[model samples]
Target: MTHPENPSTFDTVLVANRGEIAVRVIRSARAHGYRTVAVYSDADAGAPHVALADDAVRLGPAPAADSYLDVDAVIAAARTGGAQAIHPGYGFLAENARFARAVADAGLVFIGPTPDAIDLMGDKAAAKRRMADAGVPLLPGYQGTDQSDETLLAEADRIGLPLMVKAAAGGGGKGMRLVTDATDLRDALAAARREATSAFGDDTLILERALLHPRHVEIQVLADTHGNVVALGERDCSVQRRHQKVVEEAPSPAIDAVTRAAMQQAAVTAAADIGYVGAGTVEFLLDVERRDGDHQAFAFLEMNTRLQVEHPVTELVTGIDLVEWQLRVARGEALAFGQDDITLDGHAIEVRLYAEDPSNGYLPQTGTVEAWQPPTGAGIRVDAGIAAGQQVTAHYDPMLAKVIAHGRDRDEARRRLADALDRLVCLGVTTNRTFLARVLRHPVFAEGGATTSFLTDHDVTGVDLDPRDVAAVAGWRQLAATADAERRSPGLAGWTNATWLVDSRPLRVGADDRVVSLQATVDGIVVTVDDQRVLVTGTPDALRVEGRPVHLTVHRPGGDRLLVHLPHVDLDVSDPTGLPPGADDAAGAGVLVAPMHGAVTAVAATVGQQVEAGSQVVVMEAMKMEHVIRADVAGTLVEVVDVGDQVGVGAVVARIDPADTDG
Candidate 1:
């Protein structure tokens, strides 16, 4: 029997973040025969990470500034818990170079790249320069130190039209702008600089050439101190909204063998150049529909020094546990396998299920997970952390779970994912289930014609909100009304009272509005309107309409409204007379309201502050994304809210004084 190489292993490790990632880290560590410690804030005392760890320590209150991002608090937790290492799972302090240095100075392994490497790659401009120096292909744009509007315009003209303005120290799509014309260059530069300054504490701006309908592809690379590097194929993250990834899939449908090899080789080269000694990703923008459709070229788009949120897709295809490798590398082990030893099989796709309203422009939603039940079946994996009754608070990211499906190929994977989504049951809050299901079933997506602009080009506004469906709901309500009339007074059925029948009844079902006319019958009950008959069977509590079983629960009073549980949607049925007037509106004014329940991280707008439409007024930290509430109309701000205050849906954060209204 042969012993494993570099058998050294730490007995205890600390997870430096909260929610699903922390829980995920703890599980992986335990599987590797290591004790785990969890650190959380007051809002996360009942979080899954705290409950699952061998030891739990509370940092501070719910606000991130006071806990997760506090270096001293995390170090103190590590000391008290007697942990030997710390794993900063993706957000919070994952990319903070200073924190990494502090961990090393405290004689604790950081479980990531060296602090020098993090500092070098953490700066976007500096990393780009390093990549260029390493003989890697870079975007044909300016990486200069000048931020003047005149110099930026000249650089844009030189780089050609339709260029991108990006922050030198930004990730997750913050401080990014797309300018299509020369007229908007100066303002765009100023805005980008301001955003960059606010987000990364650095305001330097850079220019990049924008590709039209480009596919976003990235390569996963791993390295060790033994001078070995391996590329784990590619992932297509083209489907995005507001520049944040919504769906990710491995074995990208757009790249062929030749293009795949080129990208993978480039990723390996980038890692070796940086002396990267951990898991990192090399992002690229692939052109899909050129004269040479088979010909693919890529440019370096920065490297993430830690494990990515989409790492599961790579794991599903390559059969490699990246967390295990991070542990192995920390133990000073040499590369166990060379590049040739790594193999990629099957296809995998991951969908980020967030607590946000898709119909409401994908605005983040917050509340308790009233009823959270995940689907269980073959070839489906659910990486979830929150339980059924967990509170989806405003202090963290809005993602509820990550649903991934692996199959023999892309089509099978898509089919399995769609099936899993169909069986998913989530109550109380709105989700992106129906919208993502439509994406999976979309003809273009099935054909693999998706790009970064797929969500923008595809029209998902009218899906599941049709007026025809509303009329069908009206049919269900007519049955309920007839049953109620019969149950109220069985003797009055034959008399056919005139006063009992003429009232107009309105019902609000789903997102549509409709009116139903009901008539009573002698037998059970015959419901008819517009020459269509809806047969009602069983009692009102358990209704069978048109040979379909439905569990009906009345939500409010007036006895006219009921919830019909269906496979795809929850139908709200009510009499037309009971329906509220002036509902189902999709228009609004220029007031910037809170996207979800969150504290105002920064309130930049002041009364009488002149701003153009789309200028950021407030930054709200909700879910995982930093949502910047922007101005919808060009006007002077009339109302401003203080920072560090709580806000929620329709809660006005700022209001633009009307041009016509007097002060």
Candidate 2:
């Protein structure tokens, strides 16, 4: 192992990224005694990564195009900061060949693959063609340059039904659509094209025949500038929603020794063929239906020309710090060991924790993280960029953190991950923590049989909120808040006449508007919700509902807002008395509001136009993903917001006159 005291080629490195990846790279760079520099946008001036770095530079505003994605600005920052190299992390311009070339032209090393390799693998169509020429098996698809809608439609017909339309210039499930019917082809193409153009500046797409119940697996490949390439192992990323991976695990349960060896060899070959250097991932779609002994049919997907978000699982299993290896390779170092020296160990599983709601159709959420407490234990690891009081805006991806667990076997790993997820407490915004925990504990996932359609085929999103638990926590929070107020105001406490008076408060919990009534008594408090009552005893720190102790963490982020964090559930409690009449209720029946904070990219609805329920009225772009806001009730549009307008959650974008109304 190389020691930190040993001299390296680069003495200082600039991380041209933000969030957790920047923090990860800075940690690795500092561990090797290299000075680290961080770049931040206006929104991240006080972010953890900024404070962690030895030096920092301000880029621009919050939007990535003006900040992180601006190659000139990033290079200028690196030069001004006296950085010898730049690490692009996983997103932004990490896989951009032009950015890589710019860094090299600026006389600074880009801590990733060569510009040629990135360009070759960055284009899905070109990469697929190259892999096919190299004798790599590929799924039947179209990768031609004729991108006209007419040509694409014809090719879709020729390729047959159930095809996947994917963006040729990007991944991360953006600009990808799965079309199973001919009627949906045109709409899918338009949506895919719009998203691709917005995300990657390219509307070009490729079509491939959709595999039946396939396992989405990718092999982690590492190579240096020298002639050495090795595949660490494979990761199963089949548990997905909207083609975006949710859960991933190293040493895929579906893969046997024979299949593993074949996939590894193919991945290494693909890397060498592209002259790949540094860390890259070769993704493949493994057909679960085609199984013969240890051999399974698989086809090339596309190569992620940089370190993957799920790289931690592979690192745990192989005992390798991929970022360190990337830095080493960027310094013109050769691979210290060959494939023969690489080995895999215990099982590891990772789940992405996002600030989105599964029940609300997985809409992205934005707000301040009033309270954040990730789990901590021997086998639990959390790579998160968020902290208490940090704002989660619509400027970036909704993924807040990643929680991983490693154990001796799959079951142990699964159990540990589930427990860790249950222990996590994130408040002041909606999240997918409960949904992820449910999936991890589901029978199909536990048995290692989850496919790409796991989310589609299962009811993992529905979390039955127990009114008892909600009321108990709400009552506890109310009493705690009263006690706090009394401590601050002795006059108010004296006016309350605590010995003779019982104060009653009404609070609303969750988006469903479930109301809980609490009454403070001399002996603890009484909680009532929907005709059910329970006696809560003990203090705020150790509360008992009906003689049963419950563990809870409470945070008050302003007037009437209480965040109660319980096991496997976090409830946002608000005082209904503090809200204007009907403010806590759902939006008016004929109004179409923004489901989340985003820019209105398209408005299909016009005033005086009649539309049916479920018709898409507005399309919003946020967190690099597009969401179509549909009409909740059939009506004639009376008012409509225009495109290019930035809207907040619950802001009315359109107003419609109900079809049954005479107005």
Candidate 3:
């Protein structure tokens, strides 16, 4: 079965990336009989990818500029580790033409498109011009090289109201903003430019007329050096928040057979025109309101010159190993099959699991992953980059894993995905697990009507939890802890008149400030929460709460932390006992603390400056995004943290004295 004429190009590959994508690439390279090398920064020295590779090399520090994005460091590591080829997996330099050229100049194969192709499609302005010339429908916008403020402002006026300002060289929704009001144009432009320069080292921008109620669809294309290309199919990526995709599925419910064929043809044409090689995706915005004759009108959005994050959905449906195809095509081999050989077998859906608090405006959270247990079933697949005891810092993206499910039909797939999310458990930090389940089960999504404005249109922040179940789980955990402790020391179980004394403890669950009491009893345990009594009977493995049986999985990672997994809810409970009496529950009430770990980028307040409540005082940058911190109470800023200072969660960045206080 081996092609003797086209021998393999390399025996070893260096994955010049980190996290889940790196682990993904390493698995495929090793399966193809190639040894794999992994590169890591100081922060990822103990990551899963490093441990999975045959050899590992250090790049530099934690900051991407000094490590993952450092061209010299990556090249040196590849050479030092004797890697015959380099695979830039999907992020830092995957679309950088200069990086691809550098790898070729170093006499190593770059397992991606040609440098010329990357350079052609990497710039949004240039890519749009080429697509239009090739007879592809394009949205009206300004991609001209007039970089003056006056020209851009004038162009905005000409382009009409409600336009989008996007970074020409940016991806992953990093440098994009939607502007509706004319008065907010200048500030939006300046902010977009600042973020663009910081993220991609390029401040060039392109403006486009915003499409209302559009469906985001993209077609996957594969090509080889033998002058052959094929379109795999389309993926519906319409569910988004803040312009970033959260849920993706194959075989879009919005398009028909005729539309699918037309989109596929256009994608193939676009790739052929550029002489593209390797795996790429062509994105389009289908305006649901506008129609060209009987069909929907779609305009070319942009072409991702690298593998996309949602590629797994395509792979599951088409029964294709895209990574293997990438390696084979890089070795001058033709595609094993033609477009006619591809067939869709089933429906698949994937949701990104992130370390964020949904109720708190989805702000990124950071901590050690004390416990992690992904769902396991016939149709579920988990692509995770984290493990127990791994520290999730603010230096990288907040995504922890991806949960994907495949089934015979769309409804079957949706139900399976929702069940998998309910069974999943992650502790030591807040996550959007429950929120994702709610979205999948929502009637709007169940009816296959989720558009780009799904999150904006629906309220998915709430989930129903019985207070009785919460109290019962907490009580069971306390009883279990006491039994374990009594086993260790018999005398610790105090006895009065030859009978063991009943014990009671207090617990705090979730974000609620109310404390519940739990008491040990001869039959089982009794819980008092919100002036209501609930009886919990049976053991920790199986419990009967008010005559209803429930299965439980409890984990005490350390200290006062308790993770209890019920049939429907997972609770992270903590017991704050043995502290000094009269401790202030609201310490630092007037002080502004950093909500997450990040570097302070801007400080707008001086120590002696008086400010009103909810005044913006500091701006922090983390994970390539910016967050503004505001004062909670009106007061004079007594102490202010400086810009460029790295702060951790709960660290006081600024202090405010009450306005009524005299100097």
| Candidate with the greatest TM-score versus the true structure | 2
lDDT of each: 0.77, 0.87, 0.84
For model 3 the local lDDT of residue 553 reads: 73
Clashing pairs in model 3, backbone N/Cα/C closer than 3 A: none
TM-score of each: 0.85, 0.94, 0.93
Worst 10 residues of 1 by lDDT: 1-10
* lDDT string, candidate 2, 488-560, tens digits: 9955852553464444556667755655666666666777777688788887887888898888888878887
Give the per-residue lDDT digits (tens) of candidate 1, residues 403-492: 899999999999999888777766556677767777888999999999998988997634544443443455445555566677797855
Give RMSD (Å) of candidate 1 vs. truth. 5.1
Candidate 1 segments exceeding 4 Å error: 1-9, 290-295, 466-545, 548-567, 570-595, 598-638, 642-646, 654-663
- Backbone clashes for every candidate come to 13, 0, 0
Reference-based lDDT, residue 510, model 2:
73
Query: For model 2, where is the 10-residue window of minimal lDDT?
Result: 1-10
